[model samples]
Target: MPVGEWDAVLVGGGVMSATLAVLLAEVRPDWRIAVLERLDDAGQESSAGWNNAGTGHAGLCEFNYTPQRPDGTVDPAGAVRVAEQFAASLVFWGRLVERGVLGPPEAFVRSVPHVGLGQGTDGVAYLRARFEALRGHPLFADLEFSDDPGVLASWLPLVLAGRTDGEPVAATRAAQGTDVDYGVLTRRLLAALRERGGEVRLRTEVTSLRRRDGRWELAVRDRASGGRRRLRARWVFVGAGGGTLPLLQSARVPEVRRYGGFPISGRFLRTERPELVAAHRAKAYGSAAPGAPPISVPHLDLRVVDGRESLLFGPFAAFSPRFLTRGRRSDLARSVRLGNLPVLLASARDNRSLIAHLVRQVTAPPSTRMAALRRFVPTARDEDWTLVAAGQRVQVLKETGGRGTLVGFGTEVVTSAGGSLAGLLGASPGASTAVAAMLDVLAACFPAQADEWRPRLAGLVPPPTPEEVARARRVLGLAPVRPAVAP
Candidate 1:
């Protein structure tokens, strides 16, 4: 059993836990912090480069963020919020790089243009409205939109090749976009935490957590040795990705009683062919199908992982009983309880479209998936691409306004027990906004110290003003955002 209690204990070795660990270490250098991971190393789960799209999800290209309103206008609020959050992440990482905590930025993050494509007359009109809505914001001032085939071909040659349907298409491009290898970044952050006297225990699974005598007592098991031990901490953060819900339930947290988790796994079609990869230098996203979940929004991305570049497309949704990819097959069955049964049932009743969408995707054949990819890249050859399993995403289900709602890819921070324990739920725009999300956790969990910590936190992660955004981009080796041209 581990003896002295820790000031903070962060569960999960993904980017979320790594970011919070580093932030706590920076803000309170005297506090003892520890990170626990079931995996042999950090970021092997959702944070891994191959498990996710690797986009710096700044709302630059993802169309789902800017939904069209009933008035035939596009709402830019969500897009701006995501853009701001991503900018905060850039500032945090940029500062860390300058302090020599992280190595060269290009090793983990690289410049990749972001584009939003809209096909057909209605699609093009909606995209034009979206462009007009976001082009005036300081964050999106450099956004460019055009319906001309020549401009789109110049932007996405691979998508334009072999296309002859003559369907009208338009796209919006943001030059200052990025692709990040979060697995590398997570490892780097954890390494920095260790250098600052923080402890990281790998291959240690936290089996359960109990609140006793004003502190958290955790029972952890050693995967390799079959040894069990007990550890204590003043504060506990469950950033376990899909594994978060079960841990919170085990702790008997009343706040989680009404919550349920719906596990959705994904598959991506990837091609390492140099010619195809060379033709697509951007992460190009399109709208989701009518009955699909937000995670089904199709995108063709140029992914840079471990200094190698490849093109990936189609996050074809697959049904999974396990919350985490490596989790137990009975995880879903075990999670159901009398408390959340109603929530789960109601969610099912309310989200039949999403459920049906998952059914179709799970049964979809390889030929169908390839055909879906051809929507983005008309010239994509089946021989050049292979299907690879992506990370499992556990969408949150909870009652909102007297109805059970199945939340999409947006993330939520849930705190309980007078803020002593906190957990992160939901997915998408996850790692890219981790710094900001952790900052929120800090503020919520430690309201007393927030005022004092504000100055220090600000210094570490300043607000993303135009100047700060440019500075971070410069330090991160991303291209400068050119001024927006008149639409």
Candidate 2:
């Protein structure tokens, strides 16, 4: 066995790990850092472009962020926070582009229309209220609302082409929204890290984690050489996606207690027809159907990758014990830890909503899915779109409300005192907001150094200030927009 030491060791090659690596390399260049990926390449899991919806996730089109209250009012705080995170991400990507770390903007990111659609009077009222609430925000300045048939047709003719007009409905459209190729961005960030003297080891898996003499020791297996090695680091980050839980458990960390992940497999429908694809130039999202879970919201999007124009719809959730589609089925059972048992029990008790979701998805047939798709595109042909398997998402579960609670959305950061070892858990707005999430990791663990690191972090992503927000609001024509639901 060979032994080596580094300043830090990151145990995942997805966006979260890659983003952390970039930030660490930028702030602490002298510190030796190494990345160990179990696969042959990076970003092949959740960060893969094809594995998840490509929306920038500013909360503009996702209704789940603005849940309605019994009093008819809605909360805008969650949406605003999500929007700010996305803004931070945009600034980070902008800096990465200027530094020549990423490819051309068109290769990984491009401006696309984002529309929120709804039907019937209740949906219309909700859409109208949501539009009013967000119109004044800088990030949401491009939003436009309409209930007129012609206006709806102009934004998405496919959905309105031949539908009955008597049904009360409306939509909000934002032209500034974008589609991102997270996989490409991850690769580019990895490249940048390497260029700045960081080490990225592919085909290497961290088989074990242990602490010795106040330092974290990682046992790594080199697939190509069939050799085992040990590496020591001042700090260890478990960003291993579905593999994150088991690895953290091996460290005997208290935070991994009672924490369990519910794996949700997703599938998308893709189209090859250029004319049908070109006609649909925007990303259209809608509220989940009755009795459907929030994550099951249907969306029709225009996906452009490597100079190709195509359409995609539905991240219809499926059941799988495997964390990643490409991962082993034993991942779930192996990750159960004694500490997390309480958390798991609590999660299951609290997530009655998600239990209903699991039942609905597990029993749904293909025809039912197609019928759901027809709601978004009345003219969609069953033959035009084929079901494509996407990445698996491990929804975080823990103790909440004296029982097992399952969290369908939101990201969790698990860190101990002084942040010696940290791991990110949960789902929703995953890659779209990696910059802000990693920044949180830094602030929590390295508070003193952040003052010095702040300037560099700013260079990578300009922190959202009141002035920037006000200016962006004005520029996006949000000055006239008013909040229908008061905060």
Which residue runs does candidate 1 get wrong by more than 4 Å?
none
Which one is best on TM-score? 1
Total clashes, candidate 2? 12
Write one digit per residue (lDDT tens) for candidate 1, span 233-313: 999999999999999999999989999998999899999999999899999999999988778999999998888899989
On the 0 to 100 scale, the lDDT of residue 148 in model 2 is 84
Residue 245 in candidate 1, Cα distance off native in Å:
0.5
Per-residue error (Å), model 1, residue 172: 0.7
Model 2, position 118, has a per-residue lDDT of: 71
Q: Give the deviation of candidate 2 from the true structure as CA RMSD.
A: 3.7
Candidate 2: where are CA atoms >4 Å away? 1-3, 465-487
lDDT of 2 by residue, 419-483 (tens): 98888888777888898898888888887897899888776767766555444333322232233
lDDT for predicted candidate 2 compared with the true structure: 0.80
lDDT of each: 0.92, 0.80
